[model samples]
Structure formats: structure tokens, C-alpha cells
Target: MMKMKRIALSALLSLGLTACGPMEESEPMPESMFEEQGSQALDAACTSLGTGITSHACVHSGNPADHLARTASATRVTSAPSISTKHTAYDIALPSGAEGSVTYVPATTGSYAFYRTQNVPFTVINGSTSATVPSALSQTVSSSGCLLVYVSVHDLTAGTTYIVATGPASGNAITVVPEFLDDSRTRYYRDADGDGYGSTTSIYTACTPPAGYTTQRFDCNDTVGSGASINPGATEVCGNGIDDNCDGSQC
Candidate 1:
């Protein structure tokens, strides 16, 4: 993982934003490379998402050496804080910052536009239009004692390519991911048992699970029935990681 300085820019600054080190383009690894790695266990759970297979949903702040949300049509995120207009650079690449779940921010309630590198066959939506926890620590740990990740309008990254949206804040009326850059993060850590991405409160310990919650899910393959499976299935509301259908949008 590469570490760079966060040369604080304008109001558009995001807590997820970080100067990522050069990616491991070293091997020019093929899609199958993931299979050789432990990702198989991860892949066994998650698959491609709506955004397209080339997408990335979850990334780590340190060295997102592993990616999971690459399959989904869109990436998930949370609003860290109220960003000022001066720093709204919704077009920056996070070193490895992808989101599995985001804080349902009220600021995201307005009509907004999203663009991405390409378009995946999926739907983008604003779930539970309300941020549950305020601070990361204050965030009630899930059943496993992991703090819930929150999303707000401010947390949305820029320049990746995503669909556009329009409507009331939480009541998004027209959320269209017009084949753009909907590359946010979704799958980073393995949560096969839907036991919080890494660790968290019990089912209650975690934030709002997805509409169809599951457990022990991974994002390496795309054929398992788990939420992280690349193949689509009955997705459990496993804390809104963005795999609503468990098809690996975060794959």
C-alpha cells in the first residue's frame, strides 16, 4: 500500500480521500489471478455488480491491495462531513477507497449528478436516507464490535465515473447511473456471514443491514449465493454494503 500526503484541497475534501500508492499493475494479472489468490474464498461469495465488471466498490485506506466492489455498476460511500463548495472536486481517485456501506446523509437528498468511467447494468439508489451514527467511535459497533460505516453527500468521490441522480434528498426520484463512473468501494474485507464487514455489533451491532442480509460473504468469485458472491441472489440487507442483490456490485 502506498501512502501519500492529503494536501488538503478545497471544501470538496473527503475523509475517504487519500494519496494511494501505485497499484500492483506489476503482474498485469488476469481476471483469473484472483482465483489463485484467497480471493476465491472472497469470490466464492461475490460476483459482478450492476455498474460493470471493471468497477471497484471497496478499497482500503492503507493499501487496498484487494478490491471487491469491482463488479457492481456503482460504488457505495458515506458523507463524512459537510463539505464546502470550494472543495467539491467530485472527480478524484481514491488510492483504494471503495465503500461497502455508507452513511445515509440527508445532504444527498437533493437532485445530484454522478458520472463514472463506464456503465454497468444495475440500479443506483439512496437507501435509508438518514445517517445513523455521528462519529466513527460513537458509531455503535456491530454484533462483532466493528463500527458502522456512514455515508453522506459529502463522502461521494469525484472523477471515477458514475450515474446521475435527481429527486428529493432521500426520496431520490430519478436515480440513473447513465453508464458513467459509478466506481465507489463495496468489497474490501470478507463478510461471508454478514457479520459486519470486518467486525461489528451483532446483527443489531452493525448498521442497517441490506434489504437481504447474509453472512460469510466474499468478493472473489461471482457465483456463490452469498451477498459477496459474483452471481446474483436473494441479498440480505447486510448493512447496506451496496450488494442489494448480492451480485457483487462491490465484487
Candidate 2:
């Protein structure tokens, strides 16, 4: 009986040793292999990005000095209009048909406008002493209370010009700012009833209008009926209780 027990114990010990041998051999995968696979994946991803990779860096592996050098070499791009020293603003007082002169020397040839703060009727002459105003480049009053007198000056040289108020004398001051093509100025009006059209009373000037406001000032009545015809273009309904056309007369 003792010999049989010893044989069973020895068999159990051999099975345990075999299991442990396989467990020891089955070690975790090497960390280097995982790192190599990750690198390959990153490379494939960057390659798949295609043309976008050219405009952007794949990885910011550059040192601080290298980053600083690249930032220093980069140039700033701006969309704002560039005005030369030749462009200027003038506050001039003029009676009706009287003229005021200012020196304007354009650095680059482009379309320019004499933007006035008030709706002052003015005719612009190329020279200060020239009696004849150019018929082609005539002055016009904009709806935004500013006179946008456009003048196309090609290969503009340094010179002075005269701005004369054409209408009867108001004895009011006018500010003239020489604006290049595509000025950012915009005029907004009050839209009390949330209608697209705005009233002529309130005037707001900015590059962009606020909410519930519009750039058009054609609303005859902002306090008209809810969802009613407050637009000036609407047909006037005669004798109706509601002012459908907002023309102050009911049909």
C-alpha cells in the first residue's frame, strides 16, 4: 500500500510541473513589439491624410527652438483694407455751392470714394482749381446718410482735389473720409415688430446689424398689427381699421 501511494504522489507532482512550465513559457508580449506596431499605425494614418498633411504638421516633434524659429518666419495675413498715408479725413465747413480742398495722394491705383458722415450734396473735382467736375465720376448720396461719391482714379498720382457742396447752404459741418473700394460701413434701422423692414426713425451704424434689426429703412410703421403689412410696398387698404400698408391711411 505504501508503494502505491508514492507512485500516485509522483504522478501528481509531474502534472503540476508540466502546467507550470507552459505558464512560464507563455510570457506577455514584448513592450517593444507594441511600440513598433503603434509607430506603424501612426505612419499609416499620416499617409492616409494625403494632401492635408502638407498644410499641417503630422506631429509636433520639433524642439522649442525649432518651433520658435518657424513662428518667427511666419507672416501675418489680414483682410482689412490697407490705407496709405495719402488717404485722409477732413472736417470742412461749407455753405451751399462753396468748395473745400484736401490733398490726396494715392499709393496704389484703385476705386475710391469720398464717404461723408452726413448726406451733404457735393461734387468732386479732380483738381483744387479745376472748374469742371468730371462727368463720368459723379457724386451720389447713399441711403445710409453718407454720401458715397465714387471716383475711379487709375494710376493715381499725388495731388489735391476740391469737394464742393452743390445744394443750398445748410451751414452744417461735414466729415469726409476717403474710403477705398469695399468699405465695411453699414447702416441698420429699427424693426420693432420683428418685420424684415425697418423704420426710418431709428438709425444704427455699424459693420453688422443686431438681432431683430435690418439694413433697410422702408417700414412706414413699426408698431402696426402683429404679422400685419407694415411694409411700405404693401397696397394701402382704404377704410380698414388696420393700417395694412402702414401708409398712415386705412382703406
Candidate 3:
């Protein structure tokens, strides 16, 4: 009986040991993982800009239209023939010491009038009022079978500005568009979970931020609860395993 009791005790000990298996080791996250995620998030954000628009970082000092139009000659082209016109606004980022260009492709092959307007505040070019083109603001026009308008970044201020291009009425459909010459060093933060907050370490520097990203970087846990409590001054819930205040601590 004693031997049988000892055997039963040993069996129980073995079963207990089996139940308490070895702890599984967690895999370490790769260092480049954050960077890769950030890039993907940024791509999504920029893709949302739709067609003919781009994202970049540059300085727009002020509305050049205010000064440009104010200084523009008031002599209107009275009795000018109004033709069916197509208008396009180009958003260009002109970094200091750089240049930008826009291509104007006319739908038809005929003499087309080209007009440009600077991105100015409170100025809307609805293809109604026609202002005389200023010689100072005239872009260097080039012909490669199509018209290419080039503007120097050195002449632009730091911020967002606009350039309006108007094509001739008699030609093929004219498309005015802005082109990015180079990459911008603008910083954007990754918000992989679509939370308003972004990860501090997961940062991207480009002219535009990708989808699931933002210009702001203040998220404590980008992957937690769809970015719950990721904003500044967020409440820290005790024992929830989340950094609500982005302070790297959970209550």
C-alpha cells in the first residue's frame, strides 16, 4: 500500500510538471519594421489627394495674387472673344534654391492663350475675370511640341501657393498641371491604425505623408485600440497596459 501511494504521488507530480510547460519566448521586433510601416502609411495618405494634385513641403510666403494682381495693369481686354475654357490649378512645392515646372498640353494644335495665377489668399480664378499677364511673373515658356512653363523656386516664399494655367480655346483640351522636381524633407508621422495620434519613432520625411500618417507625431501607442487615448492629455487608465498620455507608462 505504501509503495502504491508513493507511485500515485509521483504520477501527480509528473502531471503537474507537464501542465506547467516552458514559457514561450516572444520574438523581438525588427528595427526596420517601424520605418517600413511608416513608409506604407505615408503612401496611403498621399494617394488620397486624388488626380492632378501632389503633396510636398515648401514655403508659401503669402498670396502673390494680392501683390501680383494689385500691381497688374487694370487695362482690361475689352470685347475679347470668350471661348470655352478649361482651367487647372497646380499645387507646386518650391523649396529654397529649387525650381518647379508645369506642362500645358493643348487639346488642339492651334494658337492658345496661356495665363497663370499665383496661389493667393481670397483670390479665386473661376475663368470669369481675365487679368493681363505680368511680364515679371511670366514663366519661361518652352515648346517640346507641348508648352512647358518653368518657375524658379528662388523667387517663391515658403508655404503653399497656387499657379493657374489657361489654355487656348480652339486647341485640343488643355491640361495645366504642377510637377514636383525633387523630394522634400517634410516630416510626417505614421498613424498605422488610423488614429489621430501618430508614433513618435515611426517618422517619414517626404514632400507628402502616406495614408495612415499625419503631419503631427504625438501618439504613444499607435497600435493600441485603434489609437484610443493617443491624443495629448489623454487619461491614463490603471492596469490597462496602455500609455494613454504618451509618456511611456501605463497605470
**C-alpha lDDT values of all predictions:** 0.26, 0.41, 0.36
Poorly placed runs, candidate 1 (over 4 Å) = 1-87, 92-110, 120-123, 127-251
- Model 1, span 42-62: residue lDDT tens: 112222222221121111211
- lDDT by residue (99-218, candidate 2, tens digit) is 433334444343344444455445544444545444223233323222323222122324333333332224534444554332222345678777678865442221234466676666
Model 1, residue 128: distance off in Å is 2.4
Model 1, residue 132: C-alpha shift (Å) = 17
What's the distance in Å from true for residue 100, model 3?
A: 18
The per-prediction CA RMSD against the true structure, in angstroms, equals: 23.5, 27.7, 19.2
Residue 123 CA error for candidate 3 (Å)?
Answer: 26
**RMSD of candidate 3 to true structure, Å:** 19.2
Better of 1 and 2 by lDDT: 2
> What range of 10 consecutive residues in model 2 has the weakest lDDT sum?
68-77
Score every model by TM-score: 0.16, 0.27, 0.31
Give the clashing pairs for model 2. 96-169, 237-251, 238-250, 238-251, 239-250, 239-251, 240-251
**1-251 per-residue lDDT for model 3 (tens digits):** 99999999999999999999856655434445533442111232232221111221111112222111111111122222222223333333322222222222223322122222232211112223333223222233333332333331211112212233232212212222322312223445677766666666453343234567676666766775667556655777888876768777777
Candidate 2 clashes: the total is 7
C-alpha positional error of residue 154 in candidate 3 after TM-score superposition, expressed in Å: 17
Question: lDDT score, residue 84, model 1?
Answer: 19
